[model samples]
Target: MKNEPVRSEAVGISEEILRKWEAKGVSRRDFIKFCTTMTATLALPLTFAPKIAAALEDKRLPVIWVEYQSCSGDSEAFLRANQPTAAEIILDIISLEYAEVVMAAAGHQAEKSKWDAMEKYKGKYLLIVEGSIPTGEGGVYCTVGGESAVESAKKLIKNAAATITVGTCASYGGLPAAAPNPTTAVGVRDLVPGATIVNLPGCPVNADNLTATLVHFLTFGKLPAVDAIGRPKFAYGKRIHDNCERRAHFDAGQYAESFDDAGHRQGHCLYKLGCKGPEAFHNCPTIRYNEGLSWPVMAGHGCIGCASPGFWDTMSPFYRRLPQVPGFGVEATADKIGLGLVGATAAAFAVHGVASAFRKGDAMESDKVKVEE
Candidate 1:
């Protein structure tokens, strides 16, 4: 995407040289566009705007991506990120050296190229891993070229500036690590315990999450602060149901019973229809998908919460809400159990009011007789 204005960071060149070659200074329009969007995504203060602009002007960072036992769907989702701008956006800003899926190199040549890049820019490139590492059967389950997946990971991670685990596969072991775990699938953290890992926990995470993370790393010169699961707080912090468009309908008790129901046409809440946005975390609603085309909830569907740890085991059925969540024992479905209590309390109050009226009537008669006496 470079056009003499934005130079690639693959050459191991210093910032001073790149700064001079930078023909196109970040435009006022483009800089503000990114600042505004990033402010909303990260909820940063207005004061950080100047810092973000400075970060953009800084030399682009280099990245190397690896795939393990995954479907490559997360990369596909990132490929759809059509934001910031054609020249100064997230992907455009970073120098991507090696990614098996999109890399133009092939066969033995491809493997050689990746190694060369790693060695050339050791400790300077971000390592992004998609999919899970298989530990079963001597790691024979997944072999690239002649090396095992785990072995390759060990080699690359030692010198990586930072690591980003993309998708549920790389973050939580995905379906491959499910019960029985025939493949003995493990996330990047499981294999490389020493590295600071960032987990984007989704079956196919939103592209904006990926971009935001890269931006954060670029701006801060280190990975952003993450939660217990190693996910950056900005993207994976809030629940989808919080900012959902149909959240109003949810509060009002309006629901869509089924796909064929009238509520579907009326655009009622899909909470009852198995929308898992309430518990699921991510910026899907706000970022949407496919350049603001549509997200799962907007299309009249529910989230499966593929991002949650042990999601394959705990968040099963994908459609039904959790009956009992992790660390929450005896938890009932919020709607059914809560409404039931409220309804019973209202009924009991109504019966007590009737009894009180009868008692008051008899007391009034007794008082009149006493006065006559």
Candidate 2:
């Protein structure tokens, strides 16, 4: 018998992308798996995987990534993505026209590249801002190519189709806008009012979420739905507590009181140790960082609500408990609430059992009467 040649499963995927993936040792299965993962991350149906693949095959998205006042932690996180390596993302997904840290072009040449992209793809390219804009000192605090951060942001925002702010610094002013706010730093939204902006607010924004957000735009030709705070609902829809691994501990009132306690070692809930999971809305527990290896909570540390607005000040005193849980009162302890829920559930079941027995008895009595008749 003759052997059959292996058929390619590249389907709608472009040869260019396949070649790049092949060069990077990414298989067709791996590419599909990545697309599926992205589909789930976007909260889209699994059937959307093909659509996502098709979208990736379309024209490479023109993206202009700009940074101002930041530690570049978000950029670092973004570059560290391993599932779909940074090279794949940069080369296959987006035509990254301008980025200061990674681009080979420097000084005047770099500035020219950014300006050229903005002009060439006006109202077409996506703008990703990575730091806060300094409004103080006439915006002299942060400048790029002799242009003030404010001026640069205004121009970029004006010409781009939409702006995506990565990290808390770019979304809500972060540490730069913290107490005493020396630079009078503000986010891009503050600098360019009334512009369409998607805020991915985290100390170091999760790269997976950023990739998914871009995929959603490419697949649907529009940004994903956002919450009241301009954050994608798929990424920030539920509180971290809702899906935390220690949620069972929280519900059972098994809490770690101190860092050195036995409960801490046993993986008890860190609610008492200033975990803001109950009040913080993010997908950290589910999506996780470092390619889903683990998150802060999984590593025995509590979430500091780094994704929340004004987290620098509000989530401070990071080693203390929240004033109160959202629905429960300030005085109500987890134990009390947990007990109440258990008791209520037990009571409901007991009542249902008794009612069912009575109904059975009544039916028996009615049968007896019919027999006598």
Candidate 3:
């Protein structure tokens, strides 16, 4: 990503938008603070924070947000971002041309606005898909503007600069593609092959991560470095287990066997209760949710591995630790192995102490005789 600031003229944010911010009583300083916070969240140095501000202030990228088979939870998460505030996000971050839930236009008018923005921005616009694309029965399961999810995505993504699949539904087909999926739902990667795609896979994706991603793109004119699955490294680099508040309990072989147990109430590890944290990677622990307040584990719930692929099928049934163990003779649960290893280590140390004492006694006795002679 480029370290230098983008020229104001290069960005598309309008003076009218700034006026709207002013009218809403949101100060310029508050907006800059939001940008700086987001830049830091992206793991970029504070120096790049101003660059982010410039990008957001001057070059507002047009976004066409489309929803398919979803509950709009992802949008709700985005709206609840406390730093930027939902109004600022709508009016300042990006030129949100059309969204079904947020836009005042309905039916044909709303669809027209989306197409108008698409034609105007064409290769420059960003396409954000919020839900899954159903392809069963000729894509008849889900429709917007009288077009199937598959058909709309295929057409709109053709000239888009990048496509972001928000939420697990759009990113990995989520719950819709779970057991006996009648809709034959598929993610954006499958629907729009070879397209520049970023998958923010969560039951409801983190709002801060989404904003940080857009800021990174604005500053660098390209998407941030991503992992194999197109997840931004800064956000999904480490497993939740690595930063869990109850990690000490896990290392000490202490775990909550059930939800209401004393161990759980005492804030012990929930691994035995089926936390997918060991196998899941996301910034949920660090960045957290709802203004850095808390995450699932902090709230006394184990991670369901919502951010990882095939989470619905692979991570469940939730409330039990992962079962598969590699590099072992027999299948062993983490708790069983942890306790066994601890016991074995203690036994070995005890045996070594006994042997060392005997050797020391023999050497001391010989030295005493030499002194006497």
Candidate 4:
């Protein structure tokens, strides 16, 4: 268990010059405003806001965010974060010197940028890992500049003040990590021993969580408090179902039976259809998606539970509640069971009818009783 970092070094931020001004660069007032926002995001003391401003002025911390085994969805998601126009946010916050996606440079030039950032900001920058690392074939599954992503991340994370693992693909093995896990993908924690890792688990983790974590780190010079699994409690503390709007319908035992069923029209709970909100942790319901517009459940789809550990495997039966759905064979189907049962019942009825006819003949022929009787 490594200890938390104390505030920025005393002489570091408040050096000889109080303010630095460049006509083309960010203004002092703009600096203070960003700092204040950082303070509010972290819920820190007002007094510390100035410290944040001073630190940015004193030193521009480099941030290197790595990608692996991902569709670059994490990058797409961060680009789509609800606030801050994504572009301005990245450009304004920490000196994002090496992201291949957004950096102006390309090919060999892009590679050089990363090397420069690593050299200049060693032991000071932040490292954010966005996907899983392949441990197979010496980590050859994914590479940048001919070096394995694992190797690249290892070099970057070693000197970083802290590392943030965002999205389920980075936090756990994710979909690419399903069963065969061809490349044996692993998370940052597995590769970077003893480094402080803050895991934010989700398909595309709530962007606000990422921003909030960054703000907390900047304001306090330490990773925010984390839960046992290295996830920040603020976002991952509660079960989605606990705060979901459909929870009331769940408690009332109203459920959507099928795609266009009556219950569905009424917007009932989707647990019967394999919603994993009760088992997964996230702020999806609270924060929603598309800048607080709506989430899966709110959009009428059951939560696929992309945030929970091994969700692609464990909480499956994608539309059923049963944990281990019976798999008779690959060719099995519900219609098969219904037809099989119906056939057996019909056979049994036929046999019973024959037996009754042979044994008694209704007991009327032998007695020759009156027609009415």
Candidate number with greatest TM-score: 2
Per-residue alpha-carbon lDDT of candidate 1 for residues 24-100, written as tens digits (9 for 90 to 100): 56443434555556656776775665565567564668889899899999888777666654235534478888888
Better of 1 and 2 by TM-score: 2
Question: Candidate 3's residue-wise lDDT over 215-235, tens digit each?
Answer: 888888888887767788788
lDDT of 2 at 139: 93
Please report, as a residue range, the 10-residue window in candidate 3 with the lowest summed lDDT: 364-373
Name model 1 segments beyond 4 Å from true.
1-28, 85-92, 324-373
Clashes of each: 1, 1, 8, 0
lDDT (Cα, tens digit) per residue for candidate 2, span 1-373: 0123222354344556655555656676568668878988888877677678778774599999999999999899988997688888888889999988799999999999999999999999999999888999899998888999998999999999999999999998988998889999998888877899999999899999999998888889888888767789889877677789998887677889899999999999998787878667778988898778999999999999888777587677678655344353334333334323322332433455423433434324532211100
lDDT of 3 at 324: 27
**RMSD versus native structure for model 3:** 12.6
Candidate 1 vs candidate 4: the TM-score winner is 1
lDDT of 1: 0.70
Worst 10 residues of 1 by lDDT: 364-373
Give the higher-lDDT candidate: 1 or 4: 1
Q: TM-score for every candidate vs. truth?
A: 0.77, 0.83, 0.80, 0.73
Identify the runs in model 4 with alpha carbons over 4 angstroms from their true place: 1-60, 322-373
Ranked by lDDT, the better of candidates 2 and 3 is 2
Q: Candidate 4 lDDT (Cα, whole model)?
A: 0.68
lDDT of each: 0.70, 0.79, 0.74, 0.68
